[model samples]
Target: MNYFQPKPISNFNATIDIPGSKSITNRALILSALSGKTITLKNILLSDDTQYMIKALRSLGNKIEYNESSKILKIIGNKNPKYDNIDLYIGNAGTAMRFLSSYLATGTGTATLHGNSRMNERPIKDLADSLTQLGVKVEYLNKFGYPPIRITSSGVWATSVKIDGSKSSQYISSILMAAPNFKNPIDISFIGKVVSKPYIHMTLTMMKDFGASFTLKENSINIVPKEYNLSEYLIEGDMSSASYFLAMSLISNSTITLNNFFKNSIQGDSKFLDVLLKMGLTILDFKEYSITVKGTSSYKGIQLSMNDIPDVAQTLAAVALFATTPTKVWDVENMRIKETDRISALKNEISKINGDFIEFKDGFLINPKPLEMYQGDFLETYDDHRMAMSLSLIGLKVPNIKVLDPSCVSKTFPNFFEEFNKIYRED
Candidate 1:
């Protein structure tokens, strides 16, 4: 295993420029492809997930040009697509799998969507069933209700459809983005509680940005069928990536600034700032597109429900190891089905550092204390990018910590370690 050890140091301070959000980039690609016009995306993230999305879109006959030097993606939308009966492999990109499944189901011709082994295991039934309700034929190839499935395109016909949103919000977003292509106005009703409601709103807002209008009434959303307006869209820096720096600031008693922070952001992970503020970290300044955070000598801990912003749960778990009080995280059962079983991975890795933790079905409670000894010398990341990055924070306070598969961070932040080292003050 190729592992990289993050060297611990004092006086950590720097300005971080996080890349564009994976969620936003993938969603923008789908909306732009649907608009059938030239839409340019600025500051787009170039990572494993976004690459899969771009590859899948290109295979569907959409013209996409990406300039690596300028960090811009120019997409020529295909309002009417003539896709070959090609099999697309998305490699664990949930957004591309879900969004493209719906997007291709509306156009003519057959396209089979598959991915890496893990992606093949991930649930697609909710989105599949929802697409089926809209008159799209979704046939499972390997297993029922999972990917490696086939979608035979005809056209959506249902005026009203119901979907279960408890598992993933991408199901709702996928359907919402494809609704405009239907001949008639579409009404979508959710059967259960919507997890990550902000992402659903993000999808609706982006759809509106592309000239698709929607009205919400109770548990359902009504989308008007109209042509989308093609225009340039600028993606904001990922707030999920910012959580690590926020936690680092408090842990090291250093100040850090994140450029392109976007105070008025659509990302649910932006709520992470509230969690840090409650823990007694001082927000030195909140600028329009950036924020400065100054750390304190110590910090307190509290219980937090991370249902809306579960992506930051691992960052909070790592920070909890240094908290003055026990930090409890709740309403994150969905974390079990991420890139890896995060709950179990956290338990296994934290135990090695002598951190006290109690696991629950949906969440965990961590009690901070001094390190006794390491049961293991190296930390296992389970090939999850967030796990690798979050657990690396422990090396800042604890010694002899090396993370396996550090390059797994290419899933989101490709230059995480390089950029993190920029802030490390060696004296």
Candidate 2:
């Protein structure tokens, strides 16, 4: 097994440019393809997840050209293409699996969506059941309520559907994006308190940007059947990716500027910046598209509900180790069904460093420990990208810390370690 040992820095100062948002990128791809018009996407994230979305769209007959050097994509949308028995391997990308499940069902064809071992274990029943309500034929190929499911559909024209949103918000976002293509106007109602509400909002905002008409009520969203119209769009930098570096600056007592980060980001994970402020990090400057932050020698713990921003919850868990008080995070039970059982994974890894972690059903409580008292030889990443990136922050202060399977970061931030290394001032 390959391991990466992060070297501690004595004087940390660097400027980092984070990659594009994965959530926005995948949503834009679907919107662009559904539009059936030539669209140019700038600042697109080129990672395993977005690549899967791009490849799957191409397999479904959408013409897309991506330039890695310039970080741009040219997509000629494919409307109502027909194919039978097509196989798409999503490879642990939860967004692609859920979003494409509805995307494929709205078209006229039969396709099977499957993924890696962990991806197969993640729940898709909420999304599948919602699609089934819209008249799409969904069958469980292996395990019921999971991936490797066969979706056969002539087309869907359902007017109303209700979905259980407690498990994931992607299921709802999936249906919303494809709703415009449905023959009849649709009313989507939620069955429970939706987890990650911000992601759903992001989807709606993007859909409107693409020229889809939608109205938001207290509990339901009504989207009129209309064609999308978008010629060009620019994606913002990923806030979830920025969380790691933000925590890095704090633990290492350094100052770093993140370029292309917006002060007003549509992503929910942007709330992580507020959490950092509570933990003693100072934002020196905040421009429209960039922010400079400086870390402190001491940090404070905080209590917050991460239900709306579960993606960055792991980053907060890593930062908790250096806090003076116990850090309490709750109301994110849906995190269990992510790329891994993130709640359990965080508990297991945090224990290795001798930090006190109390695991609850929904979230965990972390007791702070002094940097000198923390000791661990190796930290296992469990092949989850967020796990690898978040846990690596501990190595900036604690020595002899090695991250196993570090390459797993390619799932989102492919160049995470390269950017992370910039903080280490060479001897």
Q: Name the candidate that leads on TM-score.
A: 2
Candidate 1: stretches off by over 4 Å:
371-376, 425-427
Per-residue lDDT of candidate 1, residues 116-215 (tens digit)? 8888878989888988888888899999999899988877777999999888899999989988988789889998878888899888888888888889
- In candidate 1, clashing pairs total 0
Q: Every model's Cα RMSD, please?
A: 1.4, 1.2
Best by lDDT: 2
- lDDT accuracy of residue 90 in candidate 1: 91
TM-score of 1: 0.97
Model 1, position 163, has a per-residue lDDT of 92
Each prediction's TM-score against the native? 0.97, 0.98
